[model samples]
Target: MAKGIHQEIIGRPHNLLEHYQPIDGVVDEMVDASGNPRPVWKDFIEALEGLGPEKLAQRFARADQYLRDAGVYYR
Candidate 1:
């Protein structure tokens, strides 16, 4: 999904501005306009990359199980 987001951002033309609007004076927190990950996100992206898909899925499942056990929900 992260890779998909990156691809979507990079696939757009530079002149296209209708897809997203930035908050006044605030930079995009995740990817740049060019779809490149920001420096601040480097370590996090690296960690996810290191975990690979299977481990990441396992971790996500564990987190979901924990949330279920704790009765966490959104209305």
Candidate 2:
């Protein structure tokens, strides 16, 4: 994450960071060492979190269907 870059969460329905627990030795690309969200990921994650569980599940299902329709498969 770049220093001096910041993003504000507008109309946030929830504090998305409430559930994040950074692992001691793992590197996080979307969050800083102090547990603040990186500028680029802040809005994106908040939007996703704002979708709520049911809508999120539907979106995931749609994504999976798209992948399967496109012949994206794994062994």
Candidate lDDT (C-alpha), each: 0.58, 0.68
Q: After best superposition, candidate 1 residue 25: deviation in angstroms?
A: 13
lDDT of 1 by residue, 1-75 (tens): 223233343433433333546555677886676756679987787786566555665666666667668988644
What TM-score, over all chains together, does every model reach?
Answer: 0.59, 0.59
Q: After superposition on all CA atoms, how large is the RMSD of candidate 1?
A: 8.6
Q: What is candidate 2's TM-score against the reference?
A: 0.59
lDDT of 2 by residue, 17-53 (tens): 8767999899999899999999999889889887865
Best by lDDT: 2
Over the full model, what C-alpha lDDT does candidate 2 score relative to the true structure? 0.68
